[model samples]
Target chain A: MAAAAAERERVPFTFSAAGLDHPHIHSMVQGLLDAGAQLMHIYDENPDQANALRAKFQTGQVVQELSAILHSEVDLVATSIVPSKRGALGVQVLEHDKHFLSAKAPFTTMAQLHAAEDAVRRSGKKWAVFYSERLAVEAALLADGIVQEGLIGELFQLTGSGPHRLQAETRPAWFFDPGKNGGILCDIGSHQIEQLLHYARCKDAKVLHSKVANYAHPQYGDWQDFGDATLVTDTGVSQYFRVDWFTPEGLRVWGDGRTVLHGTNGFVELRKYTDVARSAVGDHLYVVTDEEEIYFPAKGKVGIPYFRQLIDDCVLGTETAMSQEHTFRAAALAIQAQEQAISLTKAGERR
Target chain B: MAAAAAERERVPFTFSAAGLDHPHIHSMVQGLLDAGAQLMHIYDENPDQANALRAKFQTGQVVQELSAILHSEVDLVATSIVPSKRGALGVQVLEHDKHFLSAKAPFTTMAQLHAAEDAVRRSGKKWAVFYSERLAVEAALLADGIVQEGLIGELFQLTGSGPHRLQAETRPAWFFDPGKNGGILCDIGSHQIEQLLHYARCKDAKVLHSKVANYAHPQYGDWQDFGDATLVTDTGVSQYFRVDWFTPEGLRVWGDGRTVLHGTNGFVELRKYTDVARSAVGDHLYVVTDEEEIYFPAKGKVGIPYFRQLIDDCVLGTETAMSQEHTFRAAALAIQAQEQAISLTKAGERR
Candidate 1:
């Protein structure tokens, strides 16, 4: 606990958390400030919360006003704000961070994961990142590990799919909103697709076909949580993958969560618990050969512990475990896979 | 001189220089008899030579006479007869050898070259081979020596060029006839092609493209003595080769008067000289690498060379250094390359 506090105090600068009502945002902001960051700006469209926070800050000798923090011209900034229905705090944080973090933001448009990469390159600073869970950057990292080792000789194919039932949950309406990255295939399948392309060492890939569906529990009219896709490479290798939110517990959860790699000499399978509460006890990596099978253990957390490693590498000027380019490629493939699934499904309907 | 005489006495064979009057038939007949075999029949409108030879043998002598060698009831056969023209000996010899050596032959074709192999397969019985040029075969044996030692990586590509400029000679008009294997590509290139494919592991190849020209000494009647061809494999590796009978030297040769093998890691170049009246020297094998070139010293006057080796192998149960399948593939490729060249040359004229 003391070490965590000391680390928090070392942050040196921060941003406002007034408009951020989410628990996650509150925790992140408080952690940054307590780690030696100075909160520079704060605003809340919610006047009551803003006024209450403002009064509390005035009363506390250690807490300063937002204006005073900004006038200090600190070296770094951070923020977590809850956007209204008409606004998006994520995009605002990206823009403000760009200027505050040496005139460069490491996060930008949600559609282009490489936007942050470009920002880092322009800023000329060692960088680290945090993004939506939908990105599944950790999977991409695993793919990188396989390719760099030349474990499978050469990666030749990639395919993936998603579940169809979850989109029907109407209570979380934004879950069906494509604008906010809610399509099941794009949101989840993108992670796998990106990793496949990176591992295959493919510079560019053409999508052969994709199909998406919304079946079962159709309360969410516009969302699709189930999809399948196929891709063929110029070198003649083909890949097929599927995704669905609805699966029978006994049948669906078998064989390492069904992620498999077919290689010239052998294969590898991955399994991770979908439920965070139970994942820590269940995650595994299975490496199989014609002769035998070996398993490696993995534990799950709310966020990747690996991200802290990346930050450490940046601070210490050490080599990064993965390339940012691979990350970009993975992100792009995911998006492409989703788009292809949408197009193919529409074509199938026409037929 | 003593060894030649002793070989003649032990072989129970007789040579008639008059057979050379029809060089093609003479070679075919000679090859068959040298391997200790005889044709069951002979067919000719004149039958003068056949009758004369038949009369020379006593009633109990091991000899048979028939109307046509092709239709003979004999287990094996040989022919040097030419139905149409006087100097059509090369192709006649080739045709007869091919016919008898094919699976349809009642008796296997043989020669000192295949004597040992035949003995091993036939068990103590002499197989018939009806060809001369024991020295040429010897040169082939020498070339095979380098390849077997892994001087190059697995033999991947083999090619042969020409005994060019044949048509310029005032005598031997038949030397230009395509039907008689008169051209340099067929007569000399055949040998090299066989050797190259013999070394290379390739089982089959198709001609991708070719170009041919009768640039010099058109007196041979638009006969092509210069050509180049390319072959592409199903595996995506491509080989380009050139053959020219009209090179600047009085007689220029590539490969071992017959063939050369290009390996994955290195190259082997063999050159054969069959100018019998001359010192018969110029036999060379060069193993080349990016760093240095090594030349194996020529083996001088290796006795009873290729044909003798084949005979020894047949008799002794030894594996033939060069495979028959390799020879077949090389022959097929050579034929395809020739046809492609002709087609391309014609196409070029129209353009």
Candidate 2:
């Protein structure tokens, strides 16, 4: 009791839920709750969905309209809306002088991103996206710490894999449209892009070349099944990443997601999902430093620190957690890559 | 004694070494010598180089000019010349009614590839390039067998890494020129393209998109320090690969070259060089099948079977080793990727 009394208490921050569409909303909400945020309101067009999530968390009051939370003096808003609705919802959240935290692939088009940024500038509020590949994964958090501590020493390159389950049958109509999902580059590619920016510590990146294809799902005209892009960052770090929806059903996981970081001193590879044809286990990190070799099983052992830092950033009006420019630039690069992607089939065609 | 006598009595195919420049010439020549092919002549413009190579092999008579071997009765010519000179030499080898076996990046540009394809049509002699990632790596050969045995079901995708040492101080002037070395895509990328073709059983591939960069070497006008490409095969398999000259000196070996094949029933990953961040050991294979998990330490156990098969194909007119069309298609894709490459630093500028 004395130990608890002596410890500094975390200042509570109040926030609300916006769109509960993308499945990542659960994790996003869990992160906020875990970080000691007060959930005051829940807003969604569909009452059933909103009430279900509200009942599950049992912290926020269900509201029928989004404006209820927007007008309220909530510290911030948490959302995982469909890509098309994310931008407008973010603008509304910021216009009400509240911070915005949404699921990745934050905007489906450049125009929406521009308007959201404009609103953010006008309101001087925080704009953060849930790059769950890193934000949710404890392994990623551990890696960031290790990297920042100079364990690997001078990271030079990062290659990431983003093989995802399509779950095509259960997806909504907007999921099949290119303009809505923003193509594969802007959609799934955003995860790797965010990681590239963070690990490479680059403020800007140029999409050197990108390719997208609908080899299997031609039924959905422009919905891409596979996407790849290569880029060079302002810090001179090189990156290559491939995202695909062709993960075989028998593979036991959504993907064998891994990131291999090449550094000047040595290399580190994080097996985020399956350990590539080994066990079905995930969060295995292998490090070869100048002093020793370490293999760490990092699953469940680490917690999401980004959420806590972000919570503090929102409450304090500081950009220490992550700058707003990075959020916008990462999104911008993905969208630009999507816009400039070449077709994999005809070889010369563009979407 | 009976088996040894029979092997020694087998009809030996005679060949000449046309280019004594690239270090891969030693491996290419060793493969032939081990496969029971009799080296009849050594041909290079530099007589001293030809003589030195002949003295090392302790076989093959040193010839003054390349024309000496082209006019002789040699059944095949193994060449590993600069990328730009490879195609014209291939044309000469074909026109002379001799089979051609050369190192990868068989052509520097697509036009040369097209002309070589035309020559292959005009002359029925075999044309094979060494794809050593699979051809030399024991783990790859084992994976091929496993996949063929239905251990990992129908293949869907492949991810390959072709990291190589920069060896800047040891490199020649021509090695830094894209016109001579064919940039990173046509150079180290050839191994990946060939693996994609062989493992996917793909006859042809389209260069979907490609990026090349001179991130570290700004003075070398077209020398690429890194390159990546995404391609789709006619058989509906997708591939993404990254090749770079940024293997850190701390790395114990030349590269941690690896290939991961995703199949329907399971997945197989071959650690072709170092097992990466764990041990300096190479040729480690990990596989996850429906029935079991298997790990293979495949070094020194697997031999270069492609060489023996190629010798038979040359002496007896068989292509059990690999198809002529597959070779040309792999080379074509790499050359096409090189031709279509865009510089990552310059963004919109393309080769």
Candidate 3:
């Protein structure tokens, strides 16, 4: 009883879940709950989704409206609403004196991005994003630690291949709408950009080139099935990433996402989702340095520490989870890439 | 004895080695020899190089001058001369009524490319290039067959990562001169473009964006150690490739070259040189199709039929090895990328 009281006294962190539009919300809330944060409330316009969240957590008082979550005594509000609404909701959460945790791509438009920035600056509250590809995946976390330790020397290049299956029939109408889901580069490609930024240890980078194409998905109406971008940092490190909705049905996983990091001394490759024919296992990391070649299977052992760090950041007014600037910069870069992306579908006509 | 004579009569291909500059000439010559082509003569400005070629082959006669081979009865002249001079050499060989096989980047400048094209048109002689990365690598050959068989469906994208060790101390002085070496993209990047074009079944591709950086190699005097480019084909199949001279000394091979081909029904990845930590063995191919996932270790199994095909093409006026148009297009695309490459080293100054 004394220990329980001391635990609550030592770290008083409470958060609520709102806008359960994406399945990612489950993992996001579960991470915080696992970190011992109290779930204060749950809200979604869809009663089924709200009920689902309540049943999963078996906690959180169900709320009827978004205003209720905003008005609640929660320290933070986590949301995975329609991507275009995420930035606005973040602004509202901050205006109510609560920190915000958002699913990426956090903002579908530049105006929303700016508004969120203004709200955070004016309210002095955290605005964090869940870039689960890097933060939640154990192999990525392990690679980050290895890179930080200089095991592979000065990192200079990163190449990411993010391929996701397009379960078009199961998706909501807004998922196919570019304004709501953001472009492919802004949506799935954000995960790549964020991971590259964190791994390269850069404050900012220039988007040298970007392109998007509908390819075989003209039926989806303005939906891009393929996108790629190249970016370079002031320190001269470079990144190239490609995201597409063509993951074959034979793969055991939804995608076989992979990344290769080039360093001065050696290189590292992360088979994030699956190692293809070698094994059905994901989180396979291959590290090659001057002294040795190492293979690390990062499953079950390396825990996701981002959630705990984020909770502490909210409670203690810190930036350990991720710097507010880094989060904002990643979001902005994705938006810029989307805004400036050339259309490959018009290549023949342009020529 | 009759079978041996019949085999000799069946192939009846004669070739000579000239302009022994880069060591790629060794393999270029060996592939032909393995394909039962006769090495008639060898010539180089440097007598020591000519002697080295003669010693390696233990066959070709060491000619005193280029004219000896150019004016001789040799059917084809294979050369890995200085990059800038290759086009002129090809023109001369073609004008002399002999088929010309030059090591890639084939030509350094647009003027040279134009001159070579004119020569080929006038002389009606073949001007082939040895893109050994795709031609000689067994795994690549296997993947080509797989794609040709429609196992991967309609290929739409290719990504290549080519990293090479500089070994500056051992390199000739011409290598550090951008003008002489044809820059990074026109040189090593040609291999990537060639492979991508071959895999994607693209005859021509526009260089969407390209950049080169000296990064860590300014001491080498205008030597670009890194280059990357994005290209899109007329059919909308896209390609992105990066070539660098930063292969760490730790790697067992010269570089860890990899290529990934994304198709409608599946994807194929070629670990050409080494599979990093997993194995020192090269030619590891991973195939993920709609029906099954397969792995192919192609060492000593898949024979390189390119040299034999080239010999047949020369003898019978067939385009079996690689079409004349495809060869020229790959070379032209690489030169175009090099010609338009942006310098990333000056990015900070520009900003």
Q: Give the number of the best model, judged by TM-score.
A: 3
Instruction: List the candidate 1 regions with Cα displacement exceeding 4 Å.
Output: A1-153, A158-171, A201-204, A231-239, A247-257, A274-280, A300-305, A313-324, A342-351, B1-351
Instruction: Give model 3's TM-score for chain A to 2 decimal places.
Output: 0.95
Estimate every model's Cα lDDT from 0 to 1.
Answer: 0.40, 0.81, 0.87
Name the DockQ score for candidate 1. 0.01
First chain TM-score, candidate 2:
0.92
What is the DockQ for all candidates, taken in turn? 0.01, 0.26, 0.54
* lDDT of candidate 2 over B1-351, digit per residue (tens): 334335546755788999877878889999989978889998888787788788889998988778889999888999988878989999999999999998988888888888888888999888899888888888898899988898777676788888788888988888987778888898899889999989888688877778776655666766887788878787767788988876766667788788988765667888888875566888899887766566788988877788888877765667878888888888888888888887664421222
Better of 1 and 3 by TM-score: 3
DockQ, ranked from best to worst = 3, 2, 1
Q: How is the predicted docking of candidate 1 categorized under the CAPRI scheme?
A: incorrect
lDDT of 3 by residue, B1-351 (tens): 344346558766788888988999999999889888899999999999999989988998999989998888888999999999899999999999999999998999989989988998999899999998898899998888888998888787899999998888889988888899999999999998888778777677899999987766656756787889999987788899999987877787888999998987889999999987778889999999888888889999978788878877777677989988899889999999998998877422222
lDDT, model 2: 0.81
Tell me the tens digit of each residue's lDDT in model 1 across B177-205.
Answer: 65544343434444444433444445665
Off by over 4 Å in 3: A1-11, A346-351, B1-11, B346-351
Tens digit per residue, CA lDDT, model 2, A1-351:
222222215445789998888778888888888877788888777787798898898888998778888789888998888888899989988888999998988998889989988998899998899888887777777887788888776676789888887788988888888777788999999999999999988798878778776756667776787788877787767788888886666566787788888765656788898775566888888776766567888988976677878876776666766899999999999998888887764321222
Residues A1-351, candidate 1, lDDT per residue (tens digit)? 344335545753334443433323444444444444555555555555555554545421223344443344343333333212212332333344322221111222343444455554665433222232212334434534654675644343332322222323333344455554435555556545554554565555555545555433345554554555555443434455556554332222321133445443334445443321124244445443323344555443233434333333334444343355555444455566666554222221211
